[model samples]
Target: MKKRFVSMLCIIAFLFVSICGRIAYIVFSNDFTVSESYNSYVLNLETLYPVIYYYNLEKLTDNRDKYAAVLRPNERTLTDLHNLFPSSQINEITNELKAGYPLVKYVDESKIGNEKYIKTFRMSDYECVQSQLISKASSGLLSYVEPCGKREMRFHIDALGRMLRGDEGEEFEESLSNIKGIRLTLDKKVEEIAYSALSDMQNGCVVIMDVKTSSILTCISKPDKSYLNKAFSQYNVGSVFKIIVAACALENDIEFYYNCSGKTTVGDTEFSCQKNHNHGFENLSDALSNSCNCYFVNLAQKLGSKKLLATADKLGFNDDIKLYDEWSFKTANLPNKEELSSKGELSLFGFGQGKLTVSPLQMCYSLCTIGNMGVKNQVRLVYSSLDENANEDIVKYKASTRVLSEETSKELLNMLRNVVENGTGKSAEDSYHKSSGKTATAQTGRYILGTEILNTWFAGVYPSENPEYAIVVMKENGKSGNEDCAPIYREIVEKLNYL
Candidate 1:
């Protein structure tokens, strides 16, 4: 009887050892080790998607860091590890403990596609598990307890969720403490932008120019800062700088008016219109109106980069002009050596592709060159009022900088007028007001689907027969300038009784 009792005791001991070993194996694994040791813990992963997005978007827009305390893995690094460890034994063992097991803090879209999970979780549960793990790992039982990888895990989860949604706009999750009633002065309706538009705008500002009087009528900035007008913030202008290239063509006296023949090759590079579509031999006027990429590429080589840059600089491409709101604006820097290689690139550069970038205000000023008869006028925000014999009682900021010749401006205007009449900008034409304009559709980003997402734009002046007002509208990632941005401009004009 004693021998039998001892044997039973031994068997029970053996089973206990096996269970404990398996638990250790699952817990000590690299995956859980990294996730468990972080200072911050994610209780519920799915519910925090907005938190993740708001943090990143704010980071990008404000250029400030706030999430340093919460260490979470970025998305890409998590991907490689998951590929190595497909089956998670921890899931089963984790369920054996407590009431229920929470989903892992970090996930990938490729892994979590369309899968719905509960949003809320008790923070106490995460803290409890984390504390117990730390205790067990510290005793030399689980070696992987060091908290190095936890920093980026949360970030990864947020990024994955954002990628799945595909439309994370720029607005941040408003803090309850910061809520204040918005004051509206104007009675006109204010339309809320799509998530994508707001996302693109981020913490940026917008400036709308009326070229006729060198005036900036609309200036708006996000986040409600007291100073630093972002409307003039110079980013990569993309292909909008093409107007400068057109100016170069006219100024050089290169009379290749009817030379805009379909696609042309310069050096080893090929140049074509926006889509390599054939734009039969047309006059210089038609070439400017259509924004032919190939024509400008050939023209850039003839005029050369040095002369082009010089002309652009003279036309307020690199000057500090006050854009109202008590702030100054500067144009983006031009490219150098290594940039002027392939002829196709030069062509794109001429048409505002490649290294060329500018502010919307700068683009307006460049377009204004044509409307003001070749004089690139300095821009102002406030139109001044004078007392008696124009003596300065109240100082208005209205001032114009002459940057071009009258004849040259006239020639450019004639070309642009033809554009609205019969070119890519026909959508911008209003029967009520004769208009001359140019349309731009810039391609940005690497995503295959985003290639179709063009940054549409329309820059022009009204009453083409005798210009009075010049307006410019730029829509980021819109379908087309003719369809998206021009319609907005048209609507605004109609409301103003100007159309």
Candidate 2:
């Protein structure tokens, strides 16, 4: 009996020792990880950045009135969760919550914990305005959570939150809080106007810029689902290229008069005007107003490839416009002299055809140069950044350069006004503001039902006398610029007049 009792005591002591060792291993081992559900974390909200469009009188402003927030799953039943998220999304939501993670960021917080609600990806109005920008500026920090749980979590994150989290790097580490929030030149009101105008289009874009500052006010791209911003994507520029041709003619002092007999031929290639309509006895101004293709072709021959391309280069052709770090406008392209060796190719190039392509943002800036009386300001989208203390770190851009003579720009502006007053761009006339612009119906070389598809465009400036705003509107697979795009420009301008 005494031997049995001693053996039992030894066995119990060994079991106690084993259990303590196992617990110690689980607590101290690097290879072991607690379930996220049981673990808590201090999400450094300061690490997550906020993006702003405007504040006070500053162009790129960040007051932090609006910040990034996440949707935290409250104490809701499983059935309520199912109703709040779709059947497909419910599982993901539940899994994320079970893992003690946020459901998603930048969600509408007012609707949280609503059991009767159906699943919708509803965001706050401010979030809707700056969602794209926030996604770019956050750099995945918004989704990252620390594995600490000493303090309660806050859903809203901004620069102030960063200050409270305390700096945890080298003592000399630069505090970029003044540049904390990504500041953009985009105007929310103007953005809404542009968006509403293109909402019905299958695929298109609208770009608006301040002529003097070259700040982008509104940029809207259709098919809202596309990751590509169509405003920065290149498309074949039609008659709008005429603006460049006209500049070349005026700057080089090239003058000519051409009688269009519906079509012109060069190197066995027959080029016809729109619907082959004959433009009789036209000079530079008349040709521009009528959008006469024959006149430009003749003009191109006179200027030749060297002079024409020189002017195009001066106007920022074959260049990528860098709006922000790593974010840029797709480079605009033009054929080199070797490619335009023949008169036929040159003729096509003259009328904004052949291998010429430009992004709508670039097109808008080209007009803005003219509106600024030949000064080309660097196109800007991001204005600056705000730090934790709401201090601003303004982004310096390249200085404006004179790309065209003031005299030539003034003449071109008048010609553009004539286009809106009595030419193809008549549909873009704004009653409240004197608008000037050029229209183009570019052939895409794609045939649908045996009809050549066209990319229509209308690029213009508002209050033409002293241009303040330059706007470009583009539509894919359209019938005519005046019919499809110019009207949209007019609507945008008229609405802007109220603002």
User: In terms of TM-score, how similar is model 1 to the real structure?
Assistant: 0.53
Cα lDDT tens digits, model 2, 203-241, are 888999999988988777777755456777789888999
lDDT of candidate 1 at residue 269, scale 0 to 100: 64
Cα shift from native, residue 391, model 1 (Å)? 13
Worst 10 residues of 1 by lDDT: 47-56
Lowest-sum lDDT 10-residue window in model 2: 163-172
TM-score of each: 0.53, 0.76
Model 2 misplacement above 4 A: 1-47, 55-111, 114-127, 130-178
Tell me how candidate 2 scores on lDDT: 0.73
Model 1 lDDT, residue 55, Cα: 11
TM-score, candidate number 2: 0.76
Which residue runs does candidate 1 get wrong by more than 4 Å? 1-207, 220-230, 235-240, 258-261, 323-326, 341-345, 382-401, 448-453, 497-499
